[model samples]
Target: MKIAIASGKGGTGKTTLATNLASYLSEEKQIILADLDVEEPNSGLFIRAEKIFQEDRYKMIPGWVENDCTYCGICQEVCNFNAIINLGTHILVYPELCHSCYACSELCPTAALPMQKQKMGVLKHYKKGNIDFVESRLDIGQEQAVPRIAQTLDYINSISDNKEIILLDSPPGTSCPVIEATKDADKVILVTEPTPFGLHDLGLAVETMQKMNKDFTVVLNRFGVGNADVEDYCKKNNIRIIAMIPDSRQVAELYSRGELVYDKVDSFKQSLDSIKHYILGK
Candidate 1:
C-alpha cells in the first residue's frame, strides 16, 4: 500500500506523522518512506540510515544550436510557455520558463533546437534495517518542482514491490507539487491543526482531493490547542478523522531537537498505532 501524508499548508505535522508512522511500522515490516517534498525535504533529518544509492536527476530542456539555425520563427511560435523568443536575428531561450514539452524542439525546421539534459535535483536512497528512505532535493533556484517530484516518484515506484508499504511525505498545499506527490497514493492522510487557518486550508485540500476522486482521511495535529471548529466541519462534511495527536510541549521540544517522539510519548505512539491499523485494515 502506498500512503501519502500531506497537509493543506505548512507546519501542520505532515512530516511528524510520516516519520513516526514509518518508523513504527518498519519495526515489523519492510517500508519505503519517500520524501516527495523535493523543494525542502526534512524526513532525512529524522531517519538515520546508511546511504545505499545516490544520483543526479535531470530534466529535458531545449538548447539552441546556432550552427544549424535557419532563422525560422517556428521555435518561438510553438513554445506555449514563452520560453523561446525570436528577435529577428537571434533567438533567446529561458530555461526556467520551459516546461520540457518538446514542442519547439520537435517542430524546429532546421533542427536548431535540441533537447538537452539540465540538472534539476538529486536523489539519494538510504537503508536502515527493513526501512528504505528515499529523498530528492531540488537544486537551488530551480523554478519548477513538478518535474523533480515526478522523477522522484518514478524512482521510488521503480524499486518498490507490491508487498512493501510506501509512505509519501508530500509537499504542503494543494498545488502542482502536492498533486504530483500524492497522485498515485492508495490513500492520503491529510494532517491539519485545529486552528482557523488549518480549518480553512484543510477545506481547500479536501476539495482538491475530492475533485481528483481520491480516498483520503484527516489526521488532526495539535488537537487540544485550538477550537473545535475543525471537528465540527469534518463532522458536517462527513470526513473521517482517523487520528488526533494531542498538543504537548514535550512533543514540540523533541521535534525541535530533531528527535522522534513515538517511543517516548505514549499518546503519540497510540496515534501512530491508530493510523497503522487503518492502513492495515484497508
Candidate 2:
C-alpha cells in the first residue's frame, strides 16, 4: 500500500511522520520512503540515505541547427511559450522559456530545428538498513517542479515489487507538486497543527484530496498547544482523526537535532507501533 504524508502548509511534520513511520514499519515489511518534495527534500536527513543508483532527468528543448536553416517562421508561429522567435535575419531560441513541447521542432518546415536535452533534476535511490529511499533534487533556479516530482514517483513505481509498503513525503500545499505526490496513493495522512492557520489549510488540502478521489485521514501534531478549533472543524466534517502527537519538550529537542522521535524502545516506540498497526491492520 502507498501512504502519502502531506500537509497544506510547510513545517507541519510530514517528514517527521513519514520517516519515523517508515523506520518503525520496516522491521516487518519491505518499506520505501519516496521524498517527492523536489524543491527541498529533507527526509533523507533523518534517515541518512546512502544512495545506490541515480538517473538524470531531462526535457527536450528546441535549438536551431544553423547549417540547415531555411529561415522558416513556422517554428516561431507554433511555439506557444514564445520560446522561438524568428526575425528576418536570425532566429533566437530561449532555452528558459521553452516548455520542451517539441512543437517547434515538429513544425519546422526546413528541418533546421533539433531537440536538445536539458537537465532538469537528478532522481536517486538510497538504502539505509531495512528501508529503501528515493528522492528528486531539482536544479537551482528551475521552475518545473511537478515534472521532477512525477519523475521521482515513476522511479519508485518501476522498481517497486508491489509487495512493499510505499510512503511518500509529499510537498506541502494543494498545488501541482502536491497533487503529483498524492495522486494514486492508497491512503494519505494529512498532518497539521491545532491552530487556525492549520485548520484553514487543512480544509484546502481535504478539498484537493476529495477532488482527486483519494482516501485520507488527519494527524494532529502538537496536539493541545492550540485551541479546539481544528478538532471542532474535523468533527463537523466527519474526517477521521488517526493520530495525535502531544506537545513535549523531549520530542521537540529530539526533532530539533534531526533524531527520529519514536525510534527508541520506549513509550514513543509503542505510540509508533500503534500507528503502524492502525495503518497496516496486522
Candidate 3:
C-alpha cells in the first residue's frame, strides 16, 4: 500500500510519524520511505542508512535562443506565468517563473523559445535493513517545487511495485507540492495538533483531500497540550481518528536529539502500533 504522511502546516509531526513508522514497519516487511518535501527534506536526519544512489534531477524550461529568431510577441503572449517577455528586439526567459508548461516553447511561431533541461534538485536513495529511503531536495534559488516533487514521485513509482509498502513524507500544506506528493497514495495520515490553529489548518487539509477523493484519516499529535476542539471537529465531520501521540517531554527530548522515539518511548511506540494496525488492517 502507498501511504502518505502529511500535515496542513509545518511542525505538526508529519516527519515524526513518517520516519518512525517506516523504521518500525521495516522490521517485518520491506518499506520504501520517500521524503517528498523537496524544498526542505528533513526525514533523512532521523534515518541512518547507507547511500545506495544519488543523482541530479532536472526540469524542462524554455530557453531563449536568440539566434533562432523573430522577436515575435507570441512567446510572451502564450506564457500564463509571464516567464517569457518580448522586448521588441529581444526575448527574456525567467527560469524561476517558468512552470515548465512548454506553452511558450511549443507555441512560438519562430521557435525562438526552445525547451531545455535545467538543474532544479538532487535525489538521493538510501538503504538500511529492509527500508529503502529516497529524499529529493530542491536546489537553492529554485522557485518551483512541483517539478521536483513530480520527478521524485515518478522515481518512486519506477522503483516500487504492488507488494512493498511506500510511505511518502509529504510537504506541509494543501498546495501543489502536497497534492503532487499524495495524489497517488492509497491512504493519507494527516497529522495535526489539538490547538486552534492546528484545527483550522486540518480542516483545510481535510477539505482538500475530500475534493481529491482520497482515503485519509487524522492522527492528533501533542494530544494533551491543547483543548478538545480538534476532537470535536473530527467527530462532527465523521473523520476517523486513527492515533493520538501524547504530549510528552520525553518525545520532545528524543526528537530534539534526532533520535527515533518508537524505540525509546512506550507511549510513542503504542501510537505507532496503532497507526500500523490501522494501515495494515485496511
Candidate 4:
C-alpha cells in the first residue's frame, strides 16, 4: 500500500505520523518512506539513515537563443505563469516562476526558444536500521516543488515495487506541490490537531483528497489540545478518526530532540500497529 500522510496546513504533525508509522512498520515488514516535502524535508532528522546515494533532480526551462530570435512576444504571451517576459529588445526568463512545462518553448513563433535543463533539487536515498529513507531537497530560492516532487516519486517507482507498504510524507497545504505528492496514493492519512484551525484545514484537505479520488482517514495529533471541534467536524463530514495522540509535553520534548514518538512512548507503538491493521483491513 502507498500511504501518504498529509495536512492542509503546516505544524500539524504530518511528518511525525509519517516517520513513526514507517518506523513501526519497518520492524515487521520491509517498507520505503518517501518524503516528498522537497521544500522542507525533515524525515532524515528523525530517522538516522545511512546516506546511500544522491542524484540531482532537474527540470526543463525555457532558454532563449538570442541570436536566432525575432523579438516577438509570443513566448511571453503563451506562458501563463509569466515565467517568460519579452521587453522591447530582451526576453527574460524567471526560473522561480517557471513550472518547466516547456509551453513557452513549444509556442515560440520564431523558434528562438530552446529547453534547457535546470537543477532544481537533490534526491537522496538512505537506509537506517530496516527502513529505506528517500528525501528530496529543493535548492534554496527555488519556488517550483512540483517538478522536484514528481522526480522524487519517479525515483520511488524505480526503486520500490509492491513492497509491504510505502509511506509518503507530503508537504503541508492543499497546493500544487501537495496535490502532486498525494496524487495516485492508495490511501492518505490526514494528520491534524483538535483545534479550530485544524478543523478548518482538515475540511479543505478532505475536499482535496476527495477531488483526487483517494481513500483517507484522519489521525488527530495532540488530541486534547483544544476541544471536540475536530471530532465534530469529522463526524459531520463522515470522516473516520482512526487514531489519536493526546497532547504531552514529553512528546513535544522528544520531537524536539529528533526522537520518534513511538520510540519515546511504548504505548504509541500499539496505536500505530492498530492503525496499520485498520489500513490493511486486517
Which has the greatest lDDT?
A: 1
lDDT of each residue in 17-129, candidate 3, tens digit only: 99999999998888999999989899999998999899999988888888887886988888898888889888888889888888988888888777998899899999999
Q: Model 2, 196-244: lDDT tens per residue?
A: 8999999999999999988888988888798989898989999988778
Give the C-alpha lDDT of model 3: 0.91
Q: Whole-model lDDT, candidate 1?
A: 0.93
Per-candidate TM-scores read: 0.98, 0.93, 0.97, 0.94
Which lDDT tens digits does candidate 4 get at residues 1-282?
A: 788999997998988888898888888888899999988899889988799999888888888889888887888888889888889689899988887777788888777888988888899999987788999999998888888888888888888877658899999999898899999689899999988899889889999999998899999888777999889888987898898887888878888999999976866676687788876788
Q: CA lDDT, every prediction? A: 0.93, 0.86, 0.91, 0.87
Question: Against the true structure, what is every candidate's RMSD?
Answer: 0.8, 1.8, 1.1, 1.6
Error of 2 at 210 (Å): 0.9
Leading candidate by TM-score: 1
Residue 52 alpha-carbon offset, candidate 3, angstroms: 1.2
Instruction: Show the lowest summed lDDT stretch of 10 residues, model 1.
Output: 63-72
Ranking of models by lDDT: 1, 3, 4, 2
- By TM-score, rank the candidates, best first: 1, 3, 4, 2
Lowest summed lDDT across 10 adjacent residues in model 3 is found at 63-72
Clash count of each predicted structure:
0, 0, 0, 0
